[model samples]
Target: MSDTTQPPFSVLFVDDEEISRNHFARAIRADYRVHVAQGADEAIDVLARHGAEIAVLVTDFRMPGRDGDDLLRQVAHEYPQIVRILVTAYADKDMLLQTVNTGDVFRILEKPLRADKVREALQLAIARYAERETRQQRLLAMSETLGFLAHELNTPLAAISLFARSVENDVAADYDPERQKDIGAAARAMLNNAQFCLTLLSSFWATVHKSGGQQSVAEAGGREVRATRLIASLLDTYPFAGAQRDWIEVDVQGDFVVRTMPNCVALVLSSLLSNALRALADVDAPSLRLEVVDGSEPEIRMRDNGGGIAPEIRARLLQDPVTTHAGNGGHGMGMIFCNRIMQSFGGRLGIESTPGEGTTVTMSFPGPRNRL
Candidate 1:
């Protein structure tokens, strides 16, 4: 709808007395689209039928069927998007105070309703309603954007995965040991990248589609995940070449465990591991090790012998949209997403690197019983 052509904001006035209802309706008719209800039941019927079009609710406190306070409470719970104003003569100080505390009344006016006071309430209601609509629309737009990115990445990734599996089986059978190993390694790398893309898509989709006033999805919950179990699962699920596997090692202190959403933690760990392996592509002696320590808090240390990140690139890569297309395949989106995951779980992701030496990524989370 064009801004200039949009209809006046709709307002619903509920009062027990017909005279009061008509008086308030006539006062704001010029500035608002107004509807009047004789009692609470009638007002609910109007709300049920025209809730989307109604932006403001003006109800009187003294009604035979449903009092103004009762009506406003219903609106607050059921249609909070509609700003509520109580227009009533029975402004008992305690009652008014209770209404405000319960979030029922945006504004309360004494019963000798003046045209000016009613109009002012409507004006403020319209402004607040507009602000809420803008925020909701922005959230919806961002959610759609994330969904679109996930949909776009799915097609190419699926094709690559299919082709990689065919090559891994067919090409490995035809080559000698040395050449076969190389071909297998290349195929596994392609497959791993494809799997990473797929998992990321799933996570983004889940986060965008959460329900019930929940703004976003937190890390998955309901499972206790140990570092060793997580590492073993990732190794079995995603393909990694001999060189990649040889350069990486994982060790956990006895009985170390973290309370977290298993899948989210796994996704973060996989992303970090993938980034470390990508960094090691040209190292003289590539090696990555993960050691878990159980103390006041559970800590995981991932260190690599690969050429460490450059000082200039280190900070940038930690942020979103990391691009290193000129070098071996490197996209910093993984680490950026991992950082968000850690923060969501009340944990921290730490990075340390020295030029020409190596990089270490540490993830710290609550140990058993929320220790340190």
Candidate 2:
């Protein structure tokens, strides 16, 4: 018995024979709202008009002019969410296997169609559609929540940064020179960390708003930025604790322009910088170098002389969220996130390390023509 409390979800049926279309509709119209087409062309036209309303497509494999396989391929590309089912009296095993492997058809119904079997397939297809919709909604909700938290955090971070700057500037001349220097350094560190946090939050907020909490790469556009200037900015703003800033060197082979999202680049640099700093914590006379190599494929390499990563851990660093500093609240997602961002920019992130020697992280970006 059809539940008539609400409008039934729609199904599109395509068959060349008039009797087959009529019989199929009559058998299932009580449970589903049916739309029938005489051939593949008519089916495409019907889809153009009611694609959003239709949840499933049931097309006979044999039809005049554009057969079911061709129609299924077109529909699969155009309307991926719609579940497709192929109905055929003469089922070609090779063709069936190919369509199934390519994910064009959810099910293949052998004809002399059983009403119970058809109904069962429709039920399962609808369930699968519902599951995809639910998963999409959850991801959107998570993105929105993260954006909201980032937005809310911006205020306090900005306030802290402003206060730190003020303290650094308003220090009294009556204090001893050495004492004043220590106080100023502390204030500067606080200010730098606060500013870095603000930068990350702002970028995240913009990304979420631009994509409307959806998954996309090209929605956030890129712009041309000078490589030397970007490296200088990162070095100036990065929160280097006590004498750590003195341990670093910058070497630019040539100046070039890179087209990418600067905020995203900054976020990646922050993650790499944090990791490098932690690794250098116990090393003597630590050295970190930022070298920009300009060519057809532009790159910024960060080389640090620190306790290098083990081979086993380095193997899965980018592929999985695997971290060595789990005891320090590391969830191991930093490298994974960085890798994803680099890929979205049509770029790549690579790492090389030798234990007891050092680690060098490379960020390679596409040339001007390949920018995303």
Candidate 3:
């Protein structure tokens, strides 16, 4: 809402005592759209009806049926984004801390609350609520953008890949060996490009779905992924590695089965592959190898024989947004994001590198003690 029309971000002042509740609302109503509730039950009703409009909630600790903690706890669980302030006369610091920690109460004020102190607390609470709203709006906008890009690009990509594959198959069946080699190479190129687009689309879809608050679909939290298929798919679909497809090698000792989300794997590996490709760009006879270990750990190791990172940079490699491409549009949060995803999957994301030697990023998921 516009600034002029928007009633100063709303606040709900709740107290069982009539004088305190009326004073609280009166002191704040000049600067804020204040709503007053007599007890916990009325507070609940007010929240249910005007939760979206109310930015901050200031409640007395000693209410009739339920205390402010109970109301704050319910608010924290159901409407976590709302800012909560507890007004109390209780001298228990530990209890206040607990309520702050678990119930998500933003501020605590003693019973003899001054108008200035209460306003200060409400200001902080309002700021926090505004911050949360801005963050959610940004996420929603970005998710919409991702959804749009994924939808637009996927259609054309699907059509091209379908047509290209059909042509490749017809050429393979009709062409002779001599001319077939060159045509086969061309066909492979098209197929690889198509695969790369498809892989990226998977990540785009996952991101869009996640940001849109619909992350429970595939529930990639469980481990039931086809290890080899996921690996092979990532290898074929990754654009950076695919551009230099011949430079990268895959060495699978045996069939390694691991539990992880295929899309998660794709996204994590895609980030690693991208970094490897960029590192191997200017190296003489560069090579990026994908090794799936089967011994003590089932690990997917991406080893690149490119220029390694310097000691200073290596120290905070994945911990920070340390990037070699600062001038470009890269935000350098790729590794950070990848590392988080790995951790969420109960996997270890490790990295080793030497200047001028190379870099190897290993992603190992939790498995049986013997290792799959």
On lDDT, the candidate that comes out on top is 2
Query: Can you tell me which runs of candidate 3 are displaced by over 4 Å?
Result: 1-6, 90-94, 173-372
Better of 1 and 2 by TM-score: 2
Local distance difference test, per candidate?
A: 0.70, 0.76, 0.72
**Candidate 1, pairs of clashing residues:** 220-261
Candidate 2 is scored at a TM of: 0.51
- Candidate 2 residue-wise lDDT, 192-290, digit = tens: 667667656665565456544333323344345577776777777765777888888889997777554554566677678777877888898899998
Question: Please, what are the lDDT tens digits per residue for candidate 1 over residues 1-372?
Answer: 455764668899988778887888778776777888898889999999989989998887777866877888888899989999877566366667777778557888887898987778788889989777755643543443454345335443764666577666767486677766666666765766576676656654544454222332222333456777767876666547556787777777754665544455666776677668767888878888888777776777899987787777777765756644335333445555566656654677888888889999988886556521
Give the root-mean-square deviation of each candidate in angstroms: 13.0, 14.8, 14.1
Summed over model 2, clashes come to 0
For candidate 3, the C-alpha RMSD (Å) to the true structure equals 14.1
How high is the lDDT of residue 335 in model 2? Answer: 77
For model 2, the superposed segments whose C-alpha errors exceed 4 Å read: 1-195, 203-223
Who is ahead in lDDT, 2 or 3? 2
Query: What's the CA error at residue 4 for candidate 1, in Å?
Result: 49
User: With candidate 2 superimposed using the best TM-score fit, by how many Å does residue 32's alpha carbon deviate from the native?
Assistant: 37
Which ranges of candidate 1 are over 4 A from the true structure? 1-223, 323-331, 367-372
Model 3, CA-based lDDT: 0.72
